[model samples]
Target: MIAFDAFRDGETARRLAAAIAAEAQPGRSYAFMEFCGGHTHAICRYAIAEMLPANLRMVHGPGCPVCVLPVGRVDAAIAIAERTGVTLCSFGDVLRIPGSHRRSLLSAKAAGADVRVVYSPLDALALAQALPDRQVVFFAVGFETTTPPTAAVLARARHLGIGNFSVFCNHVLTPPAIAAVLGEAADRPVLDGILGPAHVAAVTGADAFAGFARDARMPVVIAGFEPLDLLQAILMLVRQANSGAARVEIQFSRGVTAAGNRAAQALTAEVFEPRAHFAWRGLGQLAESGLRPRPGFAAWNAETRFEIGDPPPEPRTACRCAEILRGLAQPADCPLFGSACTPESPHGACMVSSEGACAAEWSYGRGRRRIWKELR
Candidate 1:
């Protein structure tokens, strides 16, 4: 077993902070994007930025699944939920995301739609077993890390011959999304290095990022979520940035390897195929970034079973969530950061998920920058 407490040791953090403040180049600036919600949460929860040098800064990426889910998908879930005797199940945070009509799963449920919060796809399968009279659709949404479990449950439902269980698959791929982000350099924020997502690496393998580093000429370090792991990864990235070397490195060796969990990847591939294109909230339509159920599994694909149509264009808002997701802006810069939008009453998807930049900033009071600018 791992002594997780060791990762959070205060003395270790202080030493690492001193080393980072010393090693990071003074005149040359380094801007790294952490491409995972777990990393963003850890950085915020531990006040990691306060230890950084003036020239170095961290940018949050569009890693939160809930934050990037397009409004049309949310509207589709609501459409399914509105049908008589149909129960739409999803993660809790997804319930609060406002859709095209400013409607949400929670609001739909309040209006007597059978929207349910399930912890896992297996739970949705079990719910379908229990409620044989109603159709149970798992409103599945996530990255590679969450895709395997949904695939596993689909396999289980097939084996058990569960007739009423289906999945509204909204799983997205990481590499394509990263490529999409880098491709937007002409208009969006550019990154000097990437603090790669460890959980995503654990599922897709560290090898998935090798092409990105070589092609984009960007340094990428696969990092664990712990504070110490993050600090070490930052040091490694700074070294690469200073040396003018761009390559893929692994700092979270404890959980990630070059090849990753092959079994999980194979399982996901067995159930899903690459979608031609999918629309993200900020990134628009990116080719092969999303996944759809294999046609053979149409019996359990909710999109095939239901008659959901394209939702109308979402009404515009003053929310800067689109720019924020592209690393072009911070939550503090948003006009609605605290006044019109909040966790209690979110005006946008970014405020709805705990991993979202807006929510993390609000929850952790990220405005108190003690070391980034003031001390330096």
Candidate 2:
């Protein structure tokens, strides 16, 4: 393992910022999208974007799994929870995602559904074992980083012959969505580079992005959560762009490896198989963008066990979340930004998710700055 202190010094941050500022061209502007919710949280929490030169802009991508889950999927999960003798378990963030008729999993819980928030899949499994008579469904969502833990839970369920436990697998892939974003540049705005996900890279390896970089001719840096690490990754991308080099570089070397965690990868492969296509809230449908439990474990698959249909009626037309998630528009660009959609009562997925760009800007008090404040 690499030493953590190498990244903690403020001097490292200054050097990285200087390198980025020096390499940034005066007339040219670089738009690099960081494609992970955790990265979004790190950037806003540490105010990493403020450290970069004026020309280099960080565009938030559809990284948050909870945010990207379309309203219909959440409705399906909630419907399963509301069924008699069924218990729904999910992360706290997902519980609040609005469904049809403004009914969320949390709302279902309030209405007497057995909805429980769990930190890990194992916790849901333990609950299943404890209550053998009830059908326990774990609302599994995330990318590669959280897939192995779900796989581990599935393996335990099978080993223990736990028939009551099932999983609503909403796990998505990263590379295909990156490809979709690059393809969108033909009609929409073009992205110069990508600040790839650190947590996902730790599971799938930096090598996962090699194909995306080679095919799109876009430089991608697998970066960490720290402010210094993000700055250094930006500098590294600037250098690569200046030198006309398109490759995958791991700036967060302390946590990431070229090969990544082999054990976690193997476990994921063993339990899950890629779906032909899955719907994202903003990015729409992409081939092989999601995962389903393998046929051997179909008994524990909630989609099959619960018999959920395609999806119910979508949310109203007033929400501009689809555009906001694609990097084509901003939250302020939406008609209902602060007027109709505040943190207290969100109208769109962007405001509902904490790591969402609009939510982060609003909660951290960054977006609505007065001209006098800027002058000061």
Best by lDDT: 1
lDDT of 1 at 21: 86
Report how far off residue 67 is in candidate 1 (Å).
0.5
Give the C-alpha lDDT of model 2: 0.85
Candidate 2 runs further than 4 Å off: 1-11, 312-316, 368-376
Q: Looking at model 2, which ten-residue stretch has the lowest summed lDDT?
A: 366-375
lDDT against true structure, model 1? 0.88
RMSD of each: 2.8, 2.4
* lDDT tens readout by residue for model 2, 1-376: 7666766677778777878888899889899988887787778777778888999999888888887888889989988998999999999878888877777888899999999999999999999999989999999988888889999999889888899999999999888877877775555547888999988999999999999789889999999887888898888888888888999999888789999999999989999999987888887777999999999999999999999766644555787877777777877777777768776777777777778877776676665452225458
Off by over 4 Å in 1: 309-314, 367-376
TM-score of each: 0.96, 0.94
Tens digit per residue, CA lDDT, model 1, 128-160: 999999999999999999999999999888889
Pairs clashing within candidate 2: none
